[model samples]
Target: MSTKQENIKQLIEEYMKVNQMGPGDRLPSETALSQSFRVSRTTLRGAIRQLESEGKLLVKHGSGTFATCPLPSIPSSLDRLYSIGDMIRSAGLREDEQLESIQRISVCPPDIAEQMRFSENEPMIALERTRTANGEAVAHSINWMPEKLAGPILEGDSFSGSLFQSLEFKAGVRIVGAYSELTVPNYDDAHMTRLLKDPQATVLLLKQLHYDEMNRQVLYSLDYVRSDIFRFWVRRTR
Candidate 1:
């Protein structure tokens, strides 16, 4: 989380504490909180949603959000794997997908080829997109898959939703699992800074190798996530 977001979260917690808000107490209106904190509505909403994710708040549609009594045990986001669309919805925001580019290529980049275990110069399909949550850009993803899996995708009318879902629906290739590494990305990178439009924002760079049901590495992806709007977690078990 960014410093601004953390500060907002802390501020809210203090308000709850000072007000002696019991479990099931209603929070102040969004406008009120935004004005009180002198933050934009967007940032305030993000902080509220983060609290809800932590089981500190309960949002009831058609009803006001409430403080949870005894705060429910927030499930680990790591426990149940999710697609990008799922992640947005879980954060209580609407998801919008923008397809930037899609094409077939004969020459694979050396790094990508190594990850996919493909021979260099082999043909493949590239899918590029930007995902927004509630109209705020949240992630940019570029994916590479073998040409054989591209048939059904190419014949489709729209590729605007989940690429993993489309690949499964069209080609019968399911993304059963993935091995992912997360790191803080260089915001100074010219292209990424321009695309995301936040040169100083902290972001998560997720490099993942998606596997099929048979445990074959069938897809490779690079995803850049805006940390303020999205949070990724891991669960450790004995």
Candidate 2:
């Protein structure tokens, strides 16, 4: 890192510290920051983008950048990739899953079908599970599978069990890529009320379509993550 960059980074840190800016808080504009520090706008932009990629900030479309979830490491990108188990375990957290509902059902909603590439009326295996880290409820996940493949999975799976393992070992399938979307919402639904403490809790929802290495969609999952306990990052090449 260059000395100029180091100085600019320190400036950002000082600003955040002085403002007591926690996650999701908006930061000052680059123009304001540059003027305050008597630096060029390009330098300020680089610094802000650095903080963004570092997970210290998030650049929202149309709006200025805001403080975001804490950054653990550049390599552990919870959003870009990683299993739920791996994502939590990589953060030095002890994680477990509580199976709430795991049942076979026929017919998925059309919107859901569009996301998972399934017909509007396909039979699917629906599994709703809660993920706990350090004995606290951190996330709730719902997974859907095709009936032909998922009809045989029993409920004897433990908290330490991997869903991928269950799928591959029991049903003979592998997961490769996932098409996912992340958002923060005011969680006040029945599931959130039962599993979380606050009705106003901010949740990081990850809606994913899990595809195998052969490029066949296998699983549709909805991961509702606690914004407080978990954070995810994304990296882009300049």
Candidate 3:
């Protein structure tokens, strides 16, 4: 995001705070906002679109933009990549800080090595945790990343909360996007069944290849989500 865009976003947020705008409240017209901010219509629209993508605003056809209702469950913001911890906190849910496992891989698995674009013998770090919401296990996630990107944090106790945040704060790397894949896992799978502990449970499997600002692959993750606890949907815009 550019500085001007950040200013416009902050300005709009302040406007809402000052006016005490709630859900369904209409925002100022684009023309009025453009003129008031002294920015081009294109720039103003870009900032508004960013807010919309974040689920902060809604745009109606033939009607003006309005404040959207609070998110019920985490919606897929395909345009922007975010950390699992951030999503949990955004929905007012509790996060379990207990890590199931974290270890270093001296010999990278072939498939994972290919995904991270690492040499066959190159090392990596794996982190696994079971996330909870309201004291119930909601998901189990396993993440792998290049040692160069996560070595220190993975080896130390500082690896808590959002790994994305940890990477940025510890290593100065910013994630910008991800290649995501969603699927329904088979109930008979031993590993998944053991993690979920219910044969009849419905599960949503998410696999993502995370990329940094320069489009370099930084991390890969697999998450097994309990569908009964958390529902996910994609937002499509023409």
Candidate 4:
């Protein structure tokens, strides 16, 4: 790809982002895009062809070009445990985080404490963040851990995206497994809808109890995943 083609591709992606274009959204006509970008038709077509080859755009004869899904749907297996960041990376998307939500020291609630095998009033470091893939919100996560294990994270600025990575590298704790429960949520949350950028989005709630190598429960988490962007499956042998 020449520099001009790459630049044009980036511009087209930006245009899609700005317009909130999702799968099946049609792009402007080639002439219109060429005129808007001030580029010749040949260059614009080159960029479009590249995007089409990459499965980001689809060109149908006589039907025009349309945007494919901006991010690939993650097909996760139920037999294994994966961090949010790991899942996003496996889907060939850039994993990013936005910590604009709550991250603070708080007392663990009774139900969560019981799940973590901690006292009801146990001190915990609670973190709530929106996980993004290629700058698009994909999941919202809320995690609670005993303050003793994750206390330093609250005071430091080392957290980039993955809490699992941060825990292993910073706190010397490695999560080996988890007990998970998955469900489809029937309630509407305006806050989550706004963050996900889709008012009609369906959400899958995943609740997990994480255990370390020592077989000690260390973390409890609630992950609200955008069902449209992620697909979870399990293999069954009869």
Candidate 5:
């Protein structure tokens, strides 16, 4: 969270505390809160989302936001990497379906090439897909990989399972680890909004760079996760 978000969160909490708010109590309107805190609606919404993710606020669509008792969340440890399918399964929801598009690009995007350590002219494969659990879309992902490494699998018709598994089996490379960063995207994407089936949805953006056992960057992915459906946490020690 950014400093402004943190400050807004603190202010909201204090407002609830000072008002003797409890479960089932409704908070002030968005306009009211924004004016009271002197922050933009976007910033206010972000803070509300942060609080909602922590089980401190309940946002009932078409209704007002309300105070709520802490609710159980699907806990994901930050120490390990899990495929989107695996994460859905672990949440006890059936990994129902995926809609995908794949293409071979002659030139890689500069930023992606830089991250994956590819030469400017190196070809790559791009995969974009939306993953659903129990009939509800939970994540949208775009992945890029060196063509030399993933071309074989892309050429085959049996590429219906996890990308991680496909790379290990067909591509013959084991992805041992990944570096991931999480953030709340500040802008709304029309395509993503439609895919997730919610125009006002709060989304968490996760960027990951996966490496093989040889420590060579093999894949880079951008995953947009629905905050209402998933939550992740990291342990910190002093």
Candidate 6:
């Protein structure tokens, strides 16, 4: 979170604490709080807007802001197993996955097998998802599922949630580990023009192979996450 947002959040928490506000308690007027804190109304409003979005506060017309119900606890994000939802949730943004295609068809390109480690021309479920953060399209993903085991799942909108999550909860395939390789590629002019806002922004690509608990190969994925929206680092301790 940005420092400004963090400071505003802290102020709200303190207000809630000192006032002993409980659920359904009406918060002070925005003007009152902004004046009391000697901050611009815009900053105070930004804090409240985020709080409202996160379910901490609710605004009323001609009335006053009040606390609504709190959200149920959700598990913290972790490594080893990951999902699109986990990525967005941990980043303090909402997640939505819109399917582009899901169908079992003959491989148009035989080289997919070399990437997926399957025999040439084997059937596979090709699924594409346009990932959104804060409801804005941020990434594009493609994954291949082995055909025979995938059954009906390969043909339709089975993407009610994360593919990895659904694989475990529905298909009994537990994802134990995976490896990823990153590359900076020449931007796809057509795709980047629409997505990156800046034509010169580069694209970050990750090609990954996922394995099951039984150590069997299950999936191969290609993720195109925009470089600007993501910042990554590695830490090595001496």
Q: How many pairs of residues collide in each model?
A: 0, 0, 0, 0, 0, 0
Model 2 scores a TM of 0.62
TM-score, one value per model: 0.66, 0.62, 0.64, 0.68, 0.68, 0.61
Residue 60 in candidate 5, Cα distance off native in Å = 14
10 residues in a row with least lDDT, candidate 4: 191-200
Cα displacement (Å) at residue 89, model 4: 0.8
Off by over 4 Å in 2: 1-80, 155-160, 198-200
Which predicted model would earn the best TM-score? 4
Write model 4 residue lDDT over 1-238, tens digit each, in one string. Answer: 7899999999998999999999899999999999999999999988988787555888887999999865678989988999988999998898998875545556777888789888876777778788988987889888888888887555564345578888888899999999999987657654356444433346788889999999999999988887777889989999
RMSD of each: 8.5, 10.3, 15.8, 10.7, 7.2, 8.2
Per-model lDDT: 0.75, 0.73, 0.76, 0.82, 0.82, 0.69
Report the lDDT tens digits of candidate 3 across residue range 55-165: 577878689989865434654464556666666777787766558777788899999988879887978888888777656566788898878888756647335677887
Superposed model 3: Cα runs more than 4 Å off: 1-73, 155-158, 194-198
In candidate 2, what are the lDDT values of residues 40-132, reduced to their tens digit? 988887777666645477778689889865634313464455777777887887778888876666778777788777897888777888887
Off by over 4 Å in 4: 1-69
Instruction: Estimate candidate 1's alpha-carbon lDDT, on a 0 to 1 scale.
Output: 0.75
TM-score sort, best first? 4, 5, 1, 3, 2, 6
Candidate 6: misplaced stretches above 4 Å? Answer: 1-81, 152-158, 189-194
Residue 68 miss distance in model 2 (angstroms):
23
**What's the lDDT for residue 145 in model 1?**
89
Least accurate 10 contiguous residues by lDDT in model 3: 191-200
Which portions of model 5 show Cα errors greater than 4 Å? 1-73, 155-158, 195-199
On a 0 to 100 scale, what is the lDDT of residue 190 in model 4? Answer: 46
lDDT of 1 by residue, 16-59 (tens): 99999988899888889989999988888777777775557777
